[model samples]
Target chain A: MQQDAARLKVTREGDIVQVEFTSRKILDEGNIAEIGDQLSVLVEAEHRPRLIISFAGVDHLSSAALGTLITINNKVKNRDGQLRLCNISPQIYEVFLITKLNTLFHIYPTVKEALESLRSGSQAGRLK
Target chain B: MKHLKLQAGPRGQRQSREKSVGLWCTEEFPSEMSEGRRVEEKILSQCRKHAYGQRDLFALKLALEEAISNAIRHGNKCTPGKNVRVKYRITRQRVDVMVEDEGHGFDPAVLPDPTADENLQRTCGRGVLLMRAYMNNVVFSPAGNSVTLTKFNESSSSSDTPLSTTTVAFG
Candidate 1:
């Protein structure tokens, strides 16, 4: 796929895949669907996908986006994979908290921290 | 001029406050996410004109997008040729928005709480929950084809429950 058409910037490091959002707002239904598909493909390709999705530069997101994240989490779990999320803005973090989704997803403050947890198998997540 | 009333005030319970002049707009768009974006931008532009803070804008943006998308997907079944109608009024204190779809309405009362442990992992069903959380008032029409959302600018989140379930006028 062309770089401009890609909704995520994905790279692999050993068993870990670091993903970054290309769109600031993950609210658009089309974009959310595409993001879900892309992530699904990546997760399915691995025996046990270790993925970290960074929310850096994301401004606004809707519940639809949250639903997409939930879908990704389920897929990773079904395959016995690990998923970590990091770099969430305060406003966006509040969305997760309001819906009580902060408990469901492994969220961290920085990509380094998320990468560490994915590697250490001691993932702890909460909004600070 | 269309007029609508809410049983509960911005601060929750029915209270009397000085009414202020407001700017209002009513529009219709095709059942497409792009059209939904147009509606969102139009409304957010209005909110910005009235000096709505970033926090208020974020809440409104989230609620409006969810409401519009629900109407398009769930209500219209993602079929083309159908339309979503939006009407909102912005005042100094608050903004009230209504979204209606052409499809038959369903009861809004039976929606499962997405926060439940079992439902937490569900891929859908969180739209209405977020709308209720961010907006001070969220009401459905008697027929359930429409939703009315209200948010008070620069106001803290409300602890008041909805005055009445499915209590909005949609014509």
Candidate 2:
């Protein structure tokens, strides 16, 4: 069994950076770290810290993937930017619950809501 | 066999042992990867009920999945002609898992670090690192075709345990 087909994309809008992960399963090891570290390097080098993750394409995630997301969250936070997630599949939502990462990161039902939250600082979750 | 006793939580104080429970299975290569992960989780949860939570169950499960994935992918190379073997062992103090492949083994030392600058964005190479991190010990055979992993049933060897098992919204 090959648990190895996932694609990642990074884009930025104003101060907010959007990261899109498209895969059937992101549970494979080093997958999260590899993608998360790439995003961190971008933030560190380009100074575009704000990040929004779209999980619409992901159906499965594991502890390692959760760890990677946490690392990305922390990286953006340290740089005075925020990491937000949107459009998580219900199955993957169960993954967040199982791993209890759902409590640590901010997840929205839609991309628009996540973007709006970044524009308004009233939300308590953003790192900045 | 000299029974080695260990605790799972803060100290041995919270430990409880089960008398006898054994479950094992094996299959050929190219089977669904998600099914393998689900099997691992089920085994660990059942073991946890008999014993206490090691807090490392999640990590161990992930490690086991990586090892098996490697065996079926790199070892068997996803060739339908080849087979990957999976074995499960549970004792009072720990749980052991072995994933073996039919291919000629590769060198572990030569394996590139997945965290390296050049390899950071790659999807592979993190399996070994994760296997080592999640389990107490990760061992490979002389041929490197097989990897063995053992996870202690206790949490005191290190301070890491299961954290909030909570929800976070994005917007």
C-alpha local distance difference test of each model: 0.82, 0.64
Model 1 interface Cα RMSD in Å: 1.2
Residues B1-171, model 2: lDDT tens digits: 344343333333233222223455554444445555666666677667645453456566667777877776678777777767777766545667888888899889898875555655344466787677667789999999999898766742343332111232343
lDDT of 1 by residue, A1-128 (tens): 22332778877777788888887875455578888888888889889889899999998888878988988998899999989899999988998988889989889999989988877777565344
Candidate 2 positional error at B132, Å: 0.6
Assign candidate 2 its CAPRI class: incorrect
Model 1 CA deviation exceeding 4 Å by range: A1-5, A124-128, B1-19, B155-171
What candidate 2 gets wrong by more than 4 Å, as runs, is A1-51, A54-128, B1-31, B52-54, B155-171
Model 1: what is its DockQ? 0.72
| TM-score to native of every candidate shown | 0.84, 0.51
Question: What DockQ does each candidate score versus the true complex, computed on alpha carbons?
Answer: 0.72, 0.08
